[model samples]
Target: MTGRSDNRPTIVITGASSGIGQATAEAFARLGARLVLAARGAEALEQVAAHCRTLGGDAIAVPTDVTDAQAVRRLADRALAFGRTIDVWVSNVGIGAVGRFQDTPIESHEQVIRANLIGHLNDAHAVMPVFLRQRFGTFINMISLGGFAATPFATSYSASKYGLRGFAEALRAEVADQPDIHVCDVYPAFIDTPGIRHGANYTGRKLSAPPPVYDARKVAAAIVDLARAPRDTTVVGSVAQFVRLGHFVAPGLSGRVMARFIRSSLDRAERVPISDGNLFAPPRDAGGIDGGLRSPKQRALVGLAAVAGLALAAVLLRSKPAYGRTGHAERGPALPPPTPRLEHSR
Candidate 1:
């Protein structure tokens, strides 16, 4: 089915209670896409669903933990009940642990891997069968630039992102013969999302995404486009391209830069305590899409930067004629080699 038709496609989103997921839900809702929203917080999911309905979109909230394969299957079943078929599944659930590796608990690291990596796997497993049966579907994987660069204090975050990139690559290959079935990977740079506030903090300093934070709506808009016209990969921030290039050109120096920032810049920021923020439990309240950290002036500046970044990517893609087996742009001659991984918009 063509995704351009208004109010036709049924979409499902994990981590839909807040941040990028919440923003994405609203975006698709505005397009008249039927939505199935899932997250650990039922109250928060219902609230988002209500907002979608107010926007004149049909939406159903199903509280789900992506870490649980069974729960994800049930989520798929419930979503199917809504519209009889699922057109898109956005695996957007992610959690972070920020601290020196030794200082962080093993449990915290494991949880990050579970939520960010294995959780996404579960999403694919539950949804791919349906896609294969229907012979057409879009699977959106929400990854970040950390998938390429090694984060110093947030080692677990880096590992999960890197793993996610690999996971998407493998899944793409497995579905190579199915032209209509699409697996889309999205890499967004630092975004002003409630995820930063909800992530676990152990650095003895409040954890925050470094500057040049893009709006969550930017990434959400990309996801909506993927639903309408499937593309293998999309990069949101310009910095993500730079990081991929830097890390490839000088791995040692790139890592050193990250380490220095974590040690000096982040360590010097506001002091905080060791606590697992919403890793194991639902947050007390469902935070909204915007993180509310940046002022209006900062947002305007970032918006311009985001536009410039998109323009640069467009020019580069046009110049470079490289296309991978999946018919998506691949890194090669004509420009600096591009990597498959990138940073988070969230």
Candidate 2:
């Protein structure tokens, strides 16, 4: 149990079972911080906590579903009980489905929105009161480059990321009076995490991140930096910064090129069996700090040509509107409602 005498910074990290969350835990653990780690999978969460303990941190696993507001509130309460003061709360979970808007199921889209956008909202909601009580705490929201740029095949993911940026900005405004209670957003480029492996794939072609993929530990170091010296916004990769600048300079031209590039990549890639991934349930093959996508065997799949084409072309892509012969905007036919799937109950 962490008491006032413990003198270690108390941090709460969601999505702690793998990827950036796991890396962040290890980074803080090396500093001997007391951590409260949360994720949906009980077994995986415990494993992460055990690892953190071995790394010199006092950690406990709290299995939580961020989509549930009450569950998130309980997690906040648990963190408070553990340390009596929540020094930082990092909302780090985001899920996605890769596919055309029409092809993906409605439930899957809703799940993405829930996990990526609303789930973060729940985390903020639960932790805000705690932070207010502490009068000085850092609240970190993990927003990817997707938050700035639109994703072509991942329509729901784009919507959720865009929404998350807006939500974080509005929350920052609301907390302006508290100088010490900071609201921070982190934007990183394509990271080599189990995120790709865990994401639902509606596109038949196998999904792989474009090059310049970063290490998860890099993002973890960024998170630790934020905890020490909180900032309004931090963009981790140079490629991400370039994309943002390009989008600002010529939004229309850059968007079209990015869309075309993704379309070409999907068309040329090899096909694979589609999966719902770990969107509705815990991953069968849970992950660690890295996804191993940068391995030599996997490197062959994403050739240099694709990365060069993507880089030379540009960035940012919001889907184009359907147009009638007369040139008026038109709405596409509505998708049929998704059927009740047994996986939802799990």
Candidate 3:
């Protein structure tokens, strides 16, 4: 609204080429928000921007790699110049790698942390000044369930997500005096998105998201709602809510269950060559919203009751000790690793 010619809310969205970013851009476009879309790929970024324009939103594409603080500063500079003022900034870029701590390359770990954590920091660094100047803005952080609890194979990803949660909390406290400035964090469960296809995989398994996946547009709707009425935390999906509470009340058992599920899933999954995925580079072309997991009828599927039952079972048995006849600790019976029920993908 500041220095703007019209009343359309000006918005900046990063990671705008694919997945939730693209969906969110489309959602806001339909709402008539002026958009500045940024991603690593110029052509793909432009494609999303073009689509937004078709939806009746004013849009421009700015190709940017958020890991570089300077580039992010430039992005902010361009966005502010184009929109006259940034009404909302979505720090939605995230990357992940799936593997044990040692099996995954150090570079992959560093890159994930850089993009997921440090890149978010850069976005905040650039936008906070603009928000302060305007005295009104919303900064949205796209965190995940990993922020609430530890993810087994994805050590770096868990670290980055947790770091993002803490970062958002700190920002919220720092800006408490600013009555109109808002810092919001969104946590979504396993959604059908191309993000899984883009994750680095060192486990040598064909990755697939587990069943009961939600749609990417579900997250987009939540983001749109948050933009309209900013909140401290917005969680998407029933399972995400259960998992967040499960971890808060039963950290030990929750972590153990998650670790076992991932290990068993990987063990039973079909073998494939390890891949670095799109960690260091962007995909060849722009991708779509869905990741082939959700159908028209399947989008409503959510196993929240099943997840709660599992958590209850784990809590009830957490006190049991596994010991052999000699009083030494012993492993429990092997879990049936039939068709992976819980995968280590996005």
Candidate 4:
């Protein structure tokens, strides 16, 4: 355990007002972790902290803008003041912009990079010193499968994820000598979160993570698990593994497949106006952990099943032989008809 035996462990989570961060905070709270929640929405952050408290955690809300380095530093100071020490710092603030790269405004792209990549960097900068002083701490970076695969409409999101993945790797390498100071990355596939509703949707269509979307709690579980058993990387959903494998085996084909999938999903979705949600300001609503967009019963295995079905169909199509109008096999001899038999009445 990261916390002291006498008291609850201290955990600081950014983007705790809603979505995956809120879910993660709740998960840790169940384990009796003292939480310091940070987000732009002060009211929402406080609400989440209250919920955590209800879950048996001692929590304090610290409204902060992670893109501002000084603000993040102040956040760290606030957390230390609240818990007296920090055991884990979760850099979970991330946003997405979905549209054709050229069609999307350059400013929107820059904003994604700033919030998703630079904000995480700021979190590390502010907390690493504290970790060094204490000689033990864990920083969890919430990266998505996009970190490994190039997404078409979400160009900036892909860039930020890729950059964040690299950042975690480098940070882990730098802290390799410190056995207790850990840098961890969580890569989840499409998750059910308000992020779909809050993201900047320039695709001229409604934005939603394609199913089978995993629950935010699924990712949260992995984050909470890190406090006990810290691993360099943890992938939450099976789809993440599949995407990584596909990308590694056939980068060009995988990219094209992803592009086609995005295009189809967007084109089929209902239209929605463009908005830079929570990018320049606080979120309009205190959206809960689950986005209500995905079913809790959904599993990443559904995707695997679909792929397996398609592969079976392809194999069957390739192996089947052409038949004439008589419907006999073209590649082999026809079989003889079965003899008829009569049965006696009992």
Per-residue lDDT tens digits for candidate 2, residues 56-76, read 789999999999999999999
Which pairs of residues collide in model 2?
none
The TM-score values for the models, in the order shown, are 0.87, 0.84, 0.86, 0.85
Candidate 3 residue-wise lDDT, 215-281, digit = tens: 7887887777667667788878767766776787789999999889888888899998899988999
Off by over 4 Å in 2: 1-5, 295-346
Q: Identify the superior model by TM-score, candidate 1 or candidate 3.
A: 1
- Candidate 3 local lDDT, residue 67: 97
> Any runs in candidate 3 off by more than 4 Å, and if so which?
1-5, 295-346
Q: Rank the candidates by lDDT, best first.
A: 3, 1, 2, 4
Q: What 10-residue stretch in candidate 4 is worst by lDDT?
A: 337-346
Q: Could you give candidate 4's per-residue lDDT for residues 1-346 as a string of tens digits?
A: 2233445678999999999999888877666678899999999999999998887678999999998999999999999988787888999998888889998899999999999999999999999999999888889898888988898888899999999989998998898888788888888888888998888877778777766787788788767666666777787766676676667657899999989988888778887777777668887889989897765446645566458645544554465542111111111111112112101100
lDDT of each: 0.81, 0.80, 0.81, 0.80
